[model samples]
Target: MKAIVITSPGGPEVLQLQDVEDPSIRDDEVLIQVAATALNRADVGQRLGSYPPPKGASPYPGLECSGTILAVGSSVHRWKPGDQVCALLSGGGYAEKVAVPEGQVLPVPEGVSLRDAGALPEVVCTVWSTVFMMSRLSPGESFLIHGGSSGIGTFAIQIAKHLGVRVFVTAGNEEKLAACKNLGADVCINYKTEDFVARIKEETGGKGGSTLMMLSSQLASVWYDISVWCFDAGVDVILDNVGGPYLQRNLDSLNIGGRLFLIGFVGGAVTEVNLAPLLIKRLTVQAAGLRSRSPENKAEIVKEVEKHVWPAIAAGKVKPVIYKSLPLSEAAEGHRLMESSIHIGKILLIP
Candidate 1:
């Protein structure tokens, strides 16, 4: 099998396509002949030597792929050879073939193409796991997602809309903001030019549902943030990827009892945050990495996604946002596009 190898962890130039030994499947796993794979921010992090694969996981950098089953392990009964599927992977998507646990594999949605299915697993699982399953973002609620033009953001906008939630998004420029808007984002703010906190405040911040209900501090007299109460309690949930730099800002953007889900730290990861808003507003903060999750956990997420999200795609309520497709040997170019952050959505590597 030919896979993209990181000759040495550094720039995109370090990624070299080479013939590698074929993957050996476990009893509960299946071998897939890759059709396509998608690029993710984590791939760049791994190439820079900051994020290494979990112990015993694939050494390559792809997190998701769409492929045809070549062989299924003895323990895997649900899938068979020739079945077309997409899978949430810990790594190894950047190859002609890779091994995956059967439970982590998903049948391609009725309306999505085989190649586009490669972009769905990671973003859909990540969004569903964090924003819906964990955060409990319900219908009629207002949700805000940062990086609205990125792969996750674009999908988040559509799914949120499909679920009858008001969506707010932040992008770096007008073009990205426009793309987000067309995808059903209600409020689009350019983080590069405006203060998102202030924008969110202006858009949804209203008389915060009786301030007394949100007060939890003994020093309640000093807890009055007029700006917060002047508008509303902000949004019901926030999905953030900017990490450390936007930590405090994310808390401020949420309503009382609001939930914040973090999946990445594209900006620097370390930052000093004021803990006041968290306590005052009763915010829930959580961060997770798909690659680090146990296979069983990923399976659970994959199951929930197929059950809850597949219909949305099949119904044409949600769609894959693909920016570009490159050959497997051009994996380096895919990384360069992702790192440049110029692309509005998922970039695929065709094998």
Candidate 2:
């Protein structure tokens, strides 16, 4: 099997395509002949040596993939060698074949191509878990997502809007904002030229709904400004991906009984957060990671996604936005595109 190996911690140049031993399946796992894999920020972090795979996981960087089952473990009952599936993987999706726990594999949605399904698992599960399940973004409520043109953001805007939530988003430019608006965002702010907080205030009448989603790296530098923004218009729920410097301000930004879902730490991990707001506002803070979750837990998320989200994709109400698709050997180029942050959606690697 040929896999994209991280030669060292650094830039895209360090990713090397090399022959590796085919993965052996555990009793409860399935071997997938990977058709495609998708690029994620986690892959970049892993390639740069900041993120490491969990114990007993693949050393390769891909987090999700689409493929056909090549073999099934003795204990696996729901899948067979001929099944067309897409799976949520902890790692090893950057190869020709990957062994995944049976529970993490899902039948590809009807009408969605096997190649495009590679981009679904990560973004769908991440958004569904954080925005809908954890944050409880109810219909008719105002919802704001940072990085509106991102994979997660693009998916989220569609899902939220489909559910009757008035969506707001911030992007780097007009084109990106227009893209988001076309996806049903009610308000789009060009973060480069406008103050998102002020825009939110103006749009929502100074009572920006209790729910917010932060998926940008820029949060680290503007945490204080956001805190001040929150002082004027309180927030309720925050689906925060960037931790570190944003922690304290996240606490400050919430209204009474606000819940914060911490999903990632692209920003530095170490930081000081004042506890006063937690006590005063009775805020609930919880952190979750999909990759390190138990197989049963992942299976539950997969089941929920299939039941609630898959139909949306099947119906053309929501769709995966693909930026580019390159051959598996050009994995480095995918990483380069991700690092450049020029892509508005998922970048795929076809095997």
Q: Can you write out model 1's per-residue Cα lDDT over 204-321, one digit (the tens) per residue?
A: 8553333333333346466553223322558999998889999988887887899999898888789998776676678899998888999989999999999999999999999999
* TM-score list, all predictions: 0.93, 0.88
Residue-level lDDT of model 2, residues 1-351, one tens digit each, is 999999999989898999999999999999999999999898988998878999999999999999999999899999999899999999999999999998888899888899999999998988887777777878767666777888888898888888888877778888898899899988888867986655655665555444333223355566332222224353555666668966876665555676777878866778976565565567788888888888888888888899999888888899889989999899999988988888897899998
Candidate 1: residue pairs that collide: 205-231, 205-232, 206-231, 206-232
- Model 2 scores worst on lDDT over the 10 consecutive residues at 223-232
Name model 2 segments beyond 4 Å from true: 207-235, 245-256, 270-281
lDDT of each: 0.90, 0.83
Model 1 TM-score, all chains together: 0.93
